[model samples]
Target: MEPTSDFDPARLARSLLRRSRQGALATLMPGTGDPYCSLVNLASHPDGSPILLISRLALHTKNILADGRVSLMLDERAEGDPLEGARVMLAGRAEEVTEAERELVRRRYLGAQPSAEVFVDFKDFSFFVIRPSGAHLVAGFGRIVDLKPGQFLTDLGGATPLLEAEAGAVAHMNEDHREAMNLYATRLLGADGADWICTGCDPDGMDMQAGRNALRLDFPERVTDGTGLRKMLVRLAGEARAKG
Candidate 1:
């Protein structure tokens, strides 16, 4: 057999956060002291903080307003047996984002949930950020650990170059780089499909989606700007072509 890669739980946990764009959010019910769970679509800040767009009328949003304490659960949904894959319960307090950060957070949310554009600007809707304090990660059966925020989250080298360019990059790829995107999905990830599209990208890597399937591809280096992204894409495409 060929040599296996080294295991890094922290890195795996970070990837899980990156790939997960939606999860169940748990909040404390007002006056009841009971736990309330609701589904929430999420995006990540460059530093891996969870960003959410919710309406004031939402029960979960009301709960957050009543008590900022909350938890977001993201997990890998595998077929067959569900517990075989990894899952994370991130405990954090949700804070309503201020005006200065609204656009930044909005763009991030749209990058993950493009459909939110319809109701994103409603008068009752608002944006919130969940600052994770700790996490409980179960990476398969025997692999489990409790991690601090720093261990499971990444800083993205401090420059959010890709964040600003995310929308344009995704559009350019889908409109002009279909073949290359499909090649990356099949060659690099060994995914069994050809209809893949580049949905979003960040400093760490890019995500590809095809029907119900999703795949993540890492950059050769931490890329922040268009020049770095172009160079990396060119190299990856060339390598994919050669391998094909």
Candidate 2:
């Protein structure tokens, strides 16, 4: 079925990508080419693609090594009937992270899954990024739609400086401006949680988390560097405070 006129498949898909902490990963088994699915913990790349850290010894990892083609299923985990909740199936090629991007990927991944720090550097574990070619989203009746990569992925063009400064900015927010984080979550995003922390930031928005609960705070306008991010955040904080 075609999506409703007002339904935003792209936005819903992006939200699932950023907020989901775990998903079902499907890979092709070697030779026979059978499908092997496993539960995996994941984090988002800055552009909203899934980043996975899997050990070489795992069956799914071995299958991925032989064939990179994969699909990931992420859902909103909404209350009530599970099947009634929104979910997206992302089809892509999972490739090992390039050396030049390893540090950045690692930081973003660890930011969302801090417990991963315990074994993030293990020799057997490697980071992989799913470069999505397409996605299928199912929200409900009249909300099923297919999306091209461009439809759901965040555009990173001209945002190199923002990426370079992301780690430091996230650190500053989590460390020094936690009250602001709480304010953004409760006031602006209408989410309730304690000890909310900044997990990552991109040109499009900031990701915040409190334990298993996560929220995405889209910027009023895109920001491209540390200065722009700071200003956008300050403005958002003021707006959030004004709501009280």
lDDT string for model 2 (34-149, tens) is 99999999999999999999999999999999999999999999899988999999999999999999999999898889899999999999999999999999999999999999
Return the TM-score for each candidate structure: 0.87, 0.98
Superposed by TM-score, candidate 1 places the C-alpha of residue 111 at a distance from the truth, in angstroms, of 3.2
TM-score of 1: 0.87
List candidate 1 segments past 4 Å from native. 1-6, 157-160
lDDT string for model 1 (1-244, tens) is: 2212465677777777877888899999999979999998887766677889999999999999999999999888877787888888999899999998887788767766778989999999999999999988886645777889889765567456766676787789889999999889888878885778776666777777775456778777788787788788989999988888
lDDT of 1: 0.82
Error of 2 at 49 (Å): 0.8
| Cand. 2 TM to true fold | 0.98
